[model samples]
Structure formats: structure tokens, C-alpha cells
Target: MNIARPLLALLVSATLLPDAVAGSFSFGLWGDMPYEKNNDAQTTAAVIRSIDRSDVAFSIFDGDIKDGSSACTDEVFSRTAKTFNAMKAPMVYVPGDNEWTDCHRKNNGGWNNLERLDTLRKLMFADGRSFGRRKLTLEHQDAPFVENTRFHKGGIVFSQVNVAGSNNNRVLDEKECSTKSARSAADCEADNAEYAARNAAVNRWIEESFAQARQRKAKGLVLTLQADPGFDLPETEELDEAKTRGWNRPESGYKDLMDTVIRETRAFDGQVLFVHGDTHVFKLDKPLHAPLDLLPNFTRLQTFGSPNNHWVHVTVNTRRPEVFTVRPVMIKAD
Candidate 1:
């Protein structure tokens, strides 16, 4: 018997298992929280406890383990990892700008932004499995982009890209970079180069994820990341309209990703949900293309952020037309 080949085949087939094979399941979503002020540690602990007590199969943290002004020290990452590992449900965390890209700020310890990003990648995405007691096998991208991953749950394809806020860390001005941190003009140039490289990797990941979903005939696809992506603007249009005036700025790092998303979502025959946490405010809508010209199959869910220290419970069922339903899970105040 060719056990090795059969075993490989079985593992490959598992990724394509149909949603009908399993019943509906729910997961938790949250991010941009637990700042170093306002009694945040207690508040975040309460939020974690609330999640632990929930019946969700897994949880997705969109990003920001700490606030922008805090130090991006190794201790912060280690402590956060410890907390995540303690969770009952498997936790999928995306990197946030506050943790790495904006670490170049003096208040954030004036670290080299790229070095901070590498450190975060090493500490958090140290393996192919998720955090928490339960684990999920994730297919990670190539080196330096391992944080980008694709996993399957309930017949839905889920992708987490290494995209963050702060204009996706594209330093538009050398002067601005120097003023914010102690970086020289060369440092700003290097930062922009880093952004360019990561942006390319992210674009490839987004495209490949959609391709995988289509190949596996997934019921729906959920794209999770940390940036807001500025859906208010007509990201797909070259319009002179008031709603899309600043859509082509150099610092707008999300435009390319947005373009790829609109294209891929239009091509896929499944329900597509874009989840992010930057800019907080707990929003759920179809803000793609434009306000009036929204993508019918696409939906956007922004999880609750700081001070608001709550989470969103998302239920995915292949039998439903929408495929995903979301509700806010509020943590009771002590």
C-alpha cells in the first residue's frame, strides 16, 4: 500500500471539505484594544474572560496588542502571547501598525520599524498552528511573509494578511518620518522600501487566497486583516466625485489591495466578508466600490476597538444565503 501518497492526498482533501459536512459554527472577532492606559489591562482581561466563557469554536484578533504610544518591547509581545495561549478557543491574531510599523515613533521606543516588524513576526507567528488551547493548522506564506496565512473552517476559506494601519506603513514624507522618530532620510527610504516589498507579498496572498477558495469550491470566504482600507472612497473608480477625491494619494497603501479585493470578490461566486479593526467604531456593511454601488456579495465587518473593549460573535453556515451573521458580544462592566 502506498501509505505516503494516500496520506498526502488525505491531507490535501481535508482542506477542501465541503461546508455541508459540518454544522454551523461561530467565532469571535476583536482588535485595536488593550491600550496601556484607562485601566485597560483589567478591561482586556474581562474581554478575554468573556470570550473564554463563550461557545465560539475559535477567535480572530484583527490586530493591535498594544496602543501606538506604548513601547514595542519583547516583553509586551511575550506577555500578549502568554495571554493568547491561555484562551480556551483557538486565537488567530493579525499584526497591527501600533505593534510594528508605528514603533518607529519615539514614544514607541524609537525602534527601527522593520526590525520591530521582524520581531513581532517571530514572536507571534512562530509556527503553523494558532494560539490557545485548541489549534488550527494554517498554510503560511513564504518567508518574511509567514504572518499571511490561509485556513479553513466550516467549509469557509479564511485568510489573514500582514496588512496594518498607518497607511500600511508607507512613509510618504522623509521630513514627517524624521519628525516622528529619530530616523534619517535614508531610514525613511528604507521604510518605504519595506512597505513596497510587504505590499507585494500581501497582494499575492490576497490573490492566491481567492484562487484557493475557488479551487476548493468554498461556500464563502473571509478576508481578515488590520487596516480599515478606507472603504468610504470609491477605491475602484478614478472619479472626480467628492466621495473619492483623495483615492489616489501616495500614502494610500490600501488602494492596490482594495483593487485586488474588488476584482477577486466579483469573480468568486461565494459570499465574501472583509473583516478589519482599524478606526474601530464597530461597523458592518457593504461599503465596497461606493455607497450606492455596493458589491452585492461582499460585506464588511469592523470589530469593536479600545475603551469599547467588546467582541463580535460571527456565525457561519453554508445553508444561509448570507453565509455569515455577526452580533456584538458586550462584556459587562464590573
Candidate 2:
């Protein structure tokens, strides 16, 4: 089944509770898993066991299920998903470049990155059950591109967006390269048109997610993605250039999605919490341009991704307004 259709079905059937209370909900958040040396199944399992014992509401795996660039076969991806599913609490995942964009290498199965993405949609988010009884789907109705997944918990709206580090662009595999070369001129043009259509759909989904958050009067917005938005601007010119261009560019689709959420949440007098993992550093630092006055509550929780794959514990208290407190907990090596 198409990803959007299942998502739509789930969303349409989901029950919405306006008076839901966002009491004390705890969840684990982490990123960048299965690195070459540090991320074995045993290590991943131990991390999950720790989270289960922590008594979290749910767990959110930030991204990077594998090294930045590696072959991601069905078996590998499935195993990783299973490991996450094994968490004691419900788990949500945002895509990372490693799982999709960087998986174009021959060793990485050399499959169409888009196709792998579709597979992910089918496996990880095809059904809305992961989010609990209330049905939730991606923001976009026609595409698997989900801007945010929203649910009411303890009277507060908890929302998540699907923004990854890489702009869903990866180097083409040999087959894709060769096929493009052998394709007729008309076929190439047609392919370009399709690409444009998909890109537009993704952009629309992003815009709609923020719009919905505003309409829903969300007390606090939890925006989760894979890449870390550049918090430091005047560091190195090379790094600055990389941040300014390509997928890392601030105004790109992902940034636009976040900016919309940040701006819209301001009108509701809510908090904006951003979570991501790309630099493999576990730290919490507010962005340089966070709108503190409009949205006084803001946090960037990027948990362990490399040396130590850790998870974040977030506590949400839903009173008239909502409060979000985050604590990063590392998975002790056994």
C-alpha cells in the first residue's frame, strides 16, 4: 500500500481529544546508531534495556541508524527497527541521511534511495499504532513526507516533524547512473518532472504541519529531525559554507519547516523544543536566533550519536500552559 494512503487512513480514523492532559510524560531520545566499531546489536540492546528501566513515556531515536555512509540492506534496516521497537515504551524515529541519502553506495545495497525511503515508510510508520490509540499520520496527505505527527497527551499537544540532516539527496548508485545515461531524452525529462512533483509535495507537507499546530493551539511544539541546525555561525568559513549550501542550508525545506513551527508557536505563547543528532555530540544548547520573547521556552536536545549512543528523558507538565524539561542520560557501557 502507498505510504500516504495508510497514513491518511490512520489519521482519519484517529480520535482526537481536545481536553487531554499533558501530565508527567517521560521518553528517551538519542541518535546515530550502529556505527562501525561502537554500534553492535548487543550494545544497542543494552542501551534499550537501560531506557526501559528509566520509566519514560516513550523513546525517540533522533536519526543516523548507521554510519553516515554505509550499505543499508533490508536485513540491517529491519534488525535496527526491531531493536528500536523492543524499547519498553513507544518509540518514534526521524530519518537520517545515513539511513537514506548516504545509503546509495554499492556496499549499501546500491538501491534507489527513494525506494529505500519508501521501504522505511512502509516498515516504520505505515500504521499509526506506534503513537498510541489516537491515530496520527504524517503532515502531507498525498506523500510519505510527514511534516509532523501530533497527539494530545496530558492536555498538551506533542508534535514531531520529519526533517533529516541531508536534503533527501544522495549520490546515485551505479544502476541509477547507468540507467539515466541509457534513458531516452523524453524519459529523462519525465523523471525530472516527477522529481519536481515529489519535492513540491514534501514542501507543502512541511508548511501544513506548522499551520496545523497553530490551529490546534498546541501548548508546546516538539520539533524533531536528524540534522542539527547550525547554532554557531562565525566558526570556520568552510563549515559556514557547508552550512549555507546544500541540505545544510538554513532556508532549505527542513529549516523552513522549523521556522514555520517556531513562528506559529509564538502566537500561542507556547514552547518550542528542537531535537536532533548529526554531529554525534550529546549536548543541549539554545540556537542563536531562538525567539525567547515570543516563545520563551526553547531547547535543543542532541543526544549521544557516536562514542556513546545515549537517550534523552523529557518531562512534560500540561497545565493551562505546558512545561517541558529535558535531561540527557547516557547508556553506561556494560
Candidate 3:
């Protein structure tokens, strides 16, 4: 090849680099939808259509393909996978309690929660590529942690960990663990064992993400999962409180993970974004209450969940100190 021609090609490639083109990119986020009682199929489809119409690098379905009350049948996962595969952009999914941990409920077909989780992993995360017509290669942890994924885009490190609600699957008591469905003390014990192993893997993934961010000198980092982590729960349970304060109030399955994130975020020089669902709330705030003062560089984004029929449009701009901006896109009834 001629030297002049080679130099010209290098220049063109440099100009076409993803971050160099605009210094910004966008992604979509949504979860806890298509609830059976809410007739959410049409709305969910509309939201997918809206995402396809927009220009985003990829979309993350944070978790909860169906409502908590729905059965965790094979068809549920298969249908959801098919839907995700049809999207124009890659869809990266995190695990949700409704699909796995809570599958032990009698109404949910009395699935062995861990077994259901294995089925989900094989069905949704069998390969290294993400779901969609335009696939993106992702780095996954070995074996059971295959769903934990990390990728880089627009000069930022992005990761998805399998952390979920239901106290991250740590059953607290006999009543809390065995009252529902076909679960026994043995099953609860097994569940907690699985939780411990996976929790360790999650922590490793977080550390690895931060290390990669530093090595790459990325402008920002994003951690996406499916649990709210109960940052705002009251100290004591009230009569009106329908849900248990699993992650941060009376008990905390997420203490180790939370500690890791806080430490790494504090150490990192760039902005940090934490995105989660499972609370069915739309919120954006700096909600970390540790160290007596909140972390100024850390931001939390909660996507629109069930009965909301909406998706969050997130834009990451390396030029901005905050790095991430979120907007909710409402899906109209079809």
C-alpha cells in the first residue's frame, strides 16, 4: 500500500471514532412492565417502537419482564427474549426477582427459584452477544455469572450486574422464607448460598469495572441493575408499608456491594451513574446517605416501572461534568 493512501485512511478512521464524532451518545432504559393485570403488552410494544425510532447506542431492560404475580413459565422468558431480539438496538437485560427469586410463589408455578434462574441465564444470555438486530459483543463472567456483563462505549465503562430485589434473595426468617409457595427451609438455605456466591461475583465485577475505567481513562462509568437498594426506607416498618425494607432498612443484603460502590465512586475521578429499577418509581437524585454527607459525583437514575408504560432516554456527554442526563418518554396507549 502507498504511504499516502494509508495515512489518509488512518485520518478517516480517527474522525469516525464513536466518541470523536460527537462526544456524546444515548441509551434507553426500562423495566418492570407488561404486567398481566395492566394490559401492558400494547404499551410495551409502543415503547419499543419509540425506542427504535430514536437514535441510541443500545437499550437496557433493567429487569422484571412481567409482573410479580405472573407465572414464571418458560414461555414468559422465551417470549420476552424474542421481543428483545426484535429490537433495532441491542438489549442488555439484568435479572429481576419476579422472573427468578420470587418464582417460588404458588401462583408462579412453584419453580425452584435457583433452577428458574439457571433457565433464564441459558435462555437470555447464552452467547457473548447482546439481543437485537444490531448485536454488540459483551464481556461476561464465567459460568453462572454469565449474565453479568461489561462493555465500553462513548469513552465510558458500562456494566450490568445480576443484583435484584427480594433482599437480593437473602431470606431473613422462617415466615419470610417459607410462608409463600413451595419453598422449604432447605430451599431457603440453598437460595441464600446461591445469593452469597453471586453477590461475591457482583462485587468482583464492580471492582473490575472500576479498574477498567481507570486503565482506559474513561470519562465516566455506569452501573445498571434491577434493585432499588432501599435507600429511602424508614427505620421501622409501618402498618401501611406493603413491602419489606430489604436492602437498607431493617436488613441489608446489599451492604457489601454498597460499600464497594461507594468506595470506588469516591476514588474515581470521573462522574459515576447508578441506574436501577424494581421500585416502580421514576426518580433521579443523589441518594447516597453514607459518610454523613452525600457523594457529589454520584448520581442515581430510576427508570419508569409498571403502570408507567414509559422508558428513560439517557444521554451521556463527555463534555459535561455530570456526564449523564435522563428524560422519561411516555408510551401512549395503542
Candidate 4:
């Protein structure tokens, strides 16, 4: 009896021992969900299904809601939004170049690109403030509109800037602009005023959000956008032409915003993950910059879209304060 009792006690001691360790949170990241002729509805459904099946806390679509030339029709926009809304977990969207930047095309609304941008602002960013429900809002009136949107489960800080690929100038066609009467000019002026106000609001939000993150001592930051700041290397002839026409890099305003974020976030002691689309290629590169010189713990992730649609999965663990892992999930269209 004594031997059996002692054995049972030993087993209980081993089983009841505490295994204390920090937990991790997983998130899904996708880019360039072009809801145009190229990306079939069935494929889009499959991607959504995959997201639904996964255990990620949330999903992020980097940008490019449709092809640049696709009409920004209500039906198209609604369908795309509906598909995305089908995901099991909530989704956060960052506008890409194709959504508004290239809406100046003849096939698109043919309206003032800036005005169309306003439409996007109303639709996707309805709150006129935060991204999702993170209580982050723009707080500056300068270049980079400061906005805060965070995923609490992952303990990640999300900041967005309203930077477009075409130098933030979605120029209306000559004929389109000229055809409008004087009355239309008044309307355009009003639209411009509203746009300016929103831009300033976003800038303010960004500054305040960064400051807040620092104050709270956040563990990591995730910055999502459509354009790649580093696109078009060497500034060669091809690069220059592409940049000029909005085919390659984004506008100067976007570049300036990226620089500002990179510079400001460097002060903190945490990982910074830069997620973007626009090039329609899935890439992961560790940009070489002085540690603490730029955004500390910065990792650049660009997921593929359109023909090679894919997604990214990131895991954050507090146990290992030194490193955070980002894993890419490539959902190829079958």
C-alpha cells in the first residue's frame, strides 16, 4: 500500500507542475486583391474560405482592390467588399494604388482622381478616424497623416498613411477636366477642401499614434500601404520613366511619409514590420539600415497579388523579446 501511494503521489506532482511561458498570436497578411477580370470570383471565394478556416486573429489586404483600368463601379466595389467581409475574422484594408490612384483611367469613373479618392475614404475608411476599432486617429496637419489601427491580440501597432502611387495626383483626363463647366469647378474646389482636411486629420493621427505607442511601450509595429518605397532601384532610364508614369514607384509624398515613419519609429526598442503591395509580386527582404538608425526591428514584407495571389502569416511571442517571426502563406489560384 505504501509503494502504490508513493507512486501515485509522484505522478500527481509531475502532472500538476506549472509550465509557465508566454503565448503567441498569429495573424494573416495578404496583398493586391485585384477584384477585376483577372481574379475570378471563385478564386476570391477560395481565398476567403482559406482565411475563414485559419485560426488567425485577423487579415490584412495590403491594396489594389481592382486593376488600375477597371471601372470603379459600385457593383465591382460592392462585390469585392462583400467577398472580403466573408472572412471569419475581421479584416483591415489599406488602400492601394489601383483602388484610387489609377482611377483616373478612362475605364474608371473618369471623375477627378482626387474626388474618387474621397469616395474611397468614405467607403473603406467610413469612421473618418481610426482604421478598424483600435481607437487610433490622425493627429497632424503635415505630410504624413498619422493614423493608429492596432490588433490587440497580436499586440501590434498599425499605422497607415494616405500615400498614392501617382504622386498623389490622380490627374483627370484633359477632356474630362475641360468639359466641366464653371459650376463644376466650384464643386471641385469644395472637394479639394474636404480632401485637404482629411489629409491633415490623418497626419495628426499618425504623429499621435506613434507617440502613444512609445508611451505605452509597445512590442511591435505593423505599417501597411500599397506602394513600395524601394521600387525602381538605381533610378535608371526605365525606372525614371516608370516612376514618372506611376508604373513603378509611388509619388514623392509617399516616399516622404515612409521616410518619416522609418525615422520616427527608430527611437523605440521594438520590431517594425512594413507590409505593402502594388508591385504585384510576393517578396520578403530585410532592408539594410543602421540598427536604431531607422525604425528599429524593421522587416519589409511584400505579398504577391493578382496572377500569383498569396498571403502572409506572422506570429508574435512575448517570451522572446528579441525576435518576432513573420511567415508567408502563398495561396495560389488552382
TM-score of 3: 0.90
The alpha-carbon deviation from the true structure for residue 283 of candidate 2, after best TM-score superposition, in angstroms, is: 2.5
The TM-score values for the models, in the order shown, are 0.90, 0.73, 0.90, 0.72
In candidate 2, what are the lDDT values of residues 98-196, reduced to their tens digit? 776545455666566666677877776665555322223433344455423555455355555555564434222444444423333443344445345
Clashes (N, CA, C under 3 Å) per candidate: 0, 10, 0, 15
For candidate 1, the lDDT comes to: 0.86
Best-fitting candidate, scored by lDDT = 3
Find the 10 residues in a row with the least total lDDT in model 3. 239-248
Runs with alpha carbons beyond 4 Å of true place in candidate 4:
1-23, 127-151, 170-202, 235-251, 288-296
What is the Å distance of residue 243 in model 4 from its true position?
A: 15
> What TM-score, to 2 decimals, does candidate 4 have?
0.72
* Candidate 2 TM-score to native: 0.73
Residue 332 Cα positional deviation in candidate 1, in Å, after optimal superposition? 2.0
Candidate 3 lDDT tens digits, 30-144? 8998899888888888999999999888999899998888789999989998899999999888888899989999888888999999999999898999999999999999897
Compose the digit string of candidate 4's lDDT tens values, residues 1-334.
3699889998888666542223466677776665566855556556667777777767777777777767766565566666665566767777776776566555665645655665765566554333322333332224223222433333456665555554443223443333422224454455346445654554555566567667667677677767776643454555443345222334243544554565666676777777777777766666534323433366778777776666777777756774457676656455
Q: lDDT score, residue 67, model 1? A: 92
What does candidate 1's lDDT look like per residue over 1-334, in tens digits?
7799999998888767754575488999988878876557777888899989998999999999999888889999999999999999999989999999888889888998888888988999999999999988889999989999889877789999988988888878757778769677888889889889989999999999999899988889999999887766544556744346233454688878887988999999999999999887898887665557668999989888888899999998888889998999888656
